[model samples]
Target: MLEVKNLYKEFNNRPILKDISFTLKDGEIMTIVGPSGAGKTTLLRIIAGLETKDSGEILIDSQAYDSGKVGVVFQDYNLFPNLNVLQNITLAPTMVLKESKEEANKKAYELLNRLQMNGREKQYPYELSGGQKQRVAIARALAMKPRILCYDEPTSALDPNLRKEVEKMILGLKKSGLTQLIITHDLQFAENVADQMLKVQPLSEG
Candidate 1:
């Protein structure tokens, strides 16, 4: 379970988020939806440890959250342009986790197979479609074995068909008992897959 308690954050003495709290149980999908400047991404970033919160407590499984326990897939699908899909997915496991190259590659292949991205291993990011890139990004994140998986604006540039693919993919992950957090402007998409919904409003400027 993930619990965020009374989170507060500010920049330049201006508040971005204030007194925000939520709980996401394990094997659940929680989607955060809001308009622009609503701090949706900021909250996600804080959870992923990409940004600092002025004050808050983030706990997973009733203990303090570790950034390593979270894996984030950015809006732009931040796959390395120069690396092939297989290399990208296996990079972290080999380097960060110090797993053997063969072991990392084996795990990457398994993830790719699950994502239906088999045979695209040698393809680079530029050679793939938006949806394909997103799948690779997801596979890369999953390879890290995070306790909670997060997506930022996952359907931003996807066509309707591709969006549906994402919806199905998320549902499949849930079946495997993965905890997920998603930040998206697409309310309908959020409704389609989220086990719970959180609506965030922008903090009024002082």
Candidate 2:
């Protein structure tokens, strides 16, 4: 559903992404694997439209969705701290999608249910466990209903065992037929859930 070509980005004359290009097919889960400073997150941001590429093209469903078109699950779980789970999840639907309050709330509730946060709708981000908070972040993104979902190492903070819970939620999204690109250092998670892997190739010496 998405394609990118010849993507290049630079910081202070140093390249962050060099000739990065790929496609995310419909209903397929693709994982971007690389070490730190490999431009994984920058690639996600550029594709999401949050950041601009110095040179490249991105197509979403035959049109351009920018990096902003990709729904993000960042490691920090950027929730509005004061907004409860349901409110946080419904914000985009109401503001961006222009749905009515009742409509947004209905969709929010259903999403929370699917994410297993049904009765916790009234809870604030600070009130939840780390996993619960990440779940809310997932629900918030899914409620946006983006055709492409991008995750930036969503399990970075959890204990290894707790990491599995968040991984399960992400894996489940893949099973539900969502098109996704996950940037991760955790190869185990990638091997378990990704349909294909995009490992960052080495930069050649001058």
Candidate 3:
């Protein structure tokens, strides 16, 4: 289980997220939805340890949160233009975990196959379609074997058909017992995949 209590954040002393709290159970999908500037992305960043929270606590399965346990897929997919799909997926594992390159490559290939990206391992990001790029991003995250995966605006760049495909993929991951946290403005997409929905509002300056 992932539990967040009284999470708070601000930029330049202007509040972004205030008193945010929620709990997401194991193997379930939680979607956070709100209008732009509601700090939805910030909240995900905080959880992923890309940004700091001013107060409160984040715990995973009764232990304190560690960024290593969280992996985030940014809205843009964030694939390296210079790296081929295989390199992109294997980079973190080899560098961070200090795993042998061969070991990382083996796991990367498995992840690619699972994500339906097998033959494209040698292709660069520029050669991939939007949906394919998203798959690569997901593969990259999954290669890390994170306990929790967070997505920011996952369907923002896709058409309705692609959105449905992503919904199916997320649901498939649930069956494999991976906890997911998604931040998106598309309520319909959120409704389709989320086991729980969280609505957030922007804080008022006044």
Candidate 4:
């Protein structure tokens, strides 16, 4: 299970997240929903270790994740322009995980297959469409094999046709039993995939 306690964050004396707390179980898809600027993204960043919390504890399966064990899928693909699809996924594992090039390539190939990116390995980011790049982004995160997956308004930036494709991919991950925490304003995405939903409202706003 993942547990968060007394989370707090501030910037320039303005509170972004205030005393937020929650727990999430493994294999569960928990979504955080609310209006814009409600601290949803801030909370996810803190949980992902992309941002520092003023005070609180984030734990995953009894291990502290102050450095963050979760993987985040940003709205933008966050891909490197110079790398091909396959290289983007393979580089991190062999480089950061210190696995052999052979071993990393094998895992990368498997993940590419699982991510339905067959025959597209040589494609550059500029060559692929937005939805496709986002799909690659998702695959790259999965290749890392994180303990928790966090998505922030994943499909919000895509057009409807493009959005459905990304939506289907996320749904596919859930069907295969990936543990996820999503923050989105899109209610349909939550209704279609979330195992549990929590609406975050500030202490005085509600």
Q: Which residue pairs come into collision in candidate 4? A: none
How far residue 64's Cα lies from its native spot in candidate 2, in Å, is 2.2
Candidate 2: where is the Cα deviation over 4 Å?
201-206
TM-scores, all candidates, are: 0.98, 0.93, 0.97, 0.92
RMSD of each: 0.8, 1.7, 1.0, 2.0
lDDT of 4 by residue, 45-127 (tens): 88888888898888888886734367778878689889999888877877777878888778777877877888888999999
Which candidate, 2 or 4, has the higher lDDT?
Answer: 2
Top lDDT hit: 1
Model 2: lDDT of residue 101:
92
- Candidate 1's displacement at residue 5, Å, is 0.3
Overall local distance difference test of candidate 1? 0.94
Task: Give the deviation of candidate 2 from the true structure as CA RMSD.
Answer: 1.7
